[model samples]
Target: MIRFGVDRLVADPDLLGGAKRVGLVTNDAARMAADPARLARVALREAGVPITRLFGPEHGLNVQSADGVHVDDGIDTMTGLPIISLYGERYCPSPAVMRDLDVVLFDIPNVGARFYTYTWTLYHMMAACTAALVPIIVLDRPNPLGGDLSLAEGPVLDLAVRSFVGEDAIPIRHQLTNGELATLWQREQFAGVRLDVLSCDGWTRAMQWPDLQLPWVPTSPAMPSFESAQLYPGTCLFEATNLSVGRGTDIPFQQIGAPWLDVPAVLSDLARRVPKGVEFSEVTFVTGLAPYAGELCHGIKITVTSASALRPVALGLLLMAAVASTHRLRFQ
Candidate 1:
């Protein structure tokens, strides 16, 4: 069984070395190995580590908010600790919030895709910690998509298009764990920042989440499964276009469609350019929130048959070309 960084921290509290009050930047997805139900904050508190303040990233601490919606800062009723929102007006914590903290701990789960916002939240947290002169202890988690460098795909973030989504110059499908990413960021960007990474035990670059025998936790509201994470790096590109990436549907990144699309023609075109490791089936859904909310959308469902054989970034580009060729596709 692979032991998570949280488990390691619980076993050895001395890693922080007498740091009493600590601030944690985490969400519900951050969990310890022993109990899947226990979040990082609760687990840390049970283990005698004082979590004085809580920090929420894009979706808030409980992950109840929708994508791209600004989360408001509030007190965690369960813990009575003040919860700061990083996705709101302030992307980073103010000096007042950082002043009382001896150390900052980060343990959010990332989908291994560059477009996802959690890693960027990490980047912001690192910057804040650097400015405050507070040490950051990153409880590193595994990249659900596996960490094979050879599988990494990119258009490598054209710094001009840098947003909250693509903050760094890393490839679209960056095959590195959060700790490895933090280390790389520290080396390339902030050399003076005090950063400590507690790596997962028994995790290798070749092992995906399925190989670890762990339960699938929703990293975000849309990303509910390992399969979703696999398809995300590719399907997420639809967000930049006029197509609906099935955001309001149960299977968000697993399907893509629009009310304006011609299903038969789109399916036929996609079949001709079918990428390896995946199968597409015609699917229709009506979203209640994002994109085409009340209107029915016609699209295809992506079934990832072989994860190892898939090249999501390349496949995404190919998909875009197919859609554009067959329909009046518009980039937003």
Candidate 2:
């Protein structure tokens, strides 16, 4: 069985060493086990862990907020804890917020892409904790995309374009668990911070989500499925352009379209230039929100034939290039 970090921690409370006031950074996606729909906060609380405060990342505590929308601090209805918004006015917790906490624990789910904001949130938390002289414990999770080093891809990051989306110079598909990322950042950037990573049991670099037999929880509003996440390392670049990457739709990131696209031509070009492991079919959509909301978009639906063979970054580039050749594509 694939045991997540949260599972291991709750199973062995001694690992936390009776910390009286603990602060947790988590979201709805951070579940403790396969049943009972218990979040990490609830699991810890039920296990007699004293959780003093809750920290929410980009999508607030519930993971329901829209993309790029700021999440505000509020009380968690179930835990009744003061929830601080890390993606709101500040990307990191203030010293005041960390004052009463013995240790800060991070247990957010990541989609294995470097540009995903959760990893950046982890970075900010590490930096803040270092300044406050508090130790940090990261309850690691699987990368969703298997952790094969050979699959690592990058344009790294050009610090000039660094935003919440892309914070460090890591590959686009970083293929490392969140705990490993915490360790990397500590060694390379925040060396002074004391960090402990509670790793997943029975998980290896070759194990994907399906291999773990875990339920698919939406990491963000747009990332709704395992297939979508598998394609996200590439499709996410569409956010920089005027294209609709199926946001506000049931199948976000699985389809790409814009009203101006010449569907037939785009599909033909994609067939000729795009890599194997994916099949495309022309589709028309009317997005209810994001990018081209209320407008008709004509594009292609991407279906992965083989997850291991898919090179999403390369496919994204080729798809963009193909669409640009047939239509007047614009980047916002």
User: TM-score of predicted model 2?
Assistant: 0.97
Clash counts for the predictions, in order = 0, 0
Per-residue lDDT tens digits for candidate 2, residues 1-332, read 77778898888888997789999999999997545277888988988888899999998889999877898999999889999999999998999999888999999999999888999999999999999988899999889998998998868999998999888899999899999999999999999899999998889999888888877988888988999999999898888888899998889899999887788988887777857799988899998977789999987999999988988898889888888877754533
| Tens digit per residue, CA lDDT, model 1, 200-319 | 999898998899888998988998888888889998988878888888778988888888777777678777886889888888899986678888988888888888999988778778
Q: Any idea what lDDT model 2 has?
A: 0.88
Query: Candidate 2: lDDT of 157?
Result: 94
| Alpha carbon lDDT at 253, candidate 2 | 91
Model 2 misplaced regions, further than 4 Å: 34-36, 328-332
Worst 10 residues of 1 by lDDT: 323-332
Query: lDDT of each structure?
Result: 0.88, 0.88
C-alpha TM-score for every candidate: 0.96, 0.97
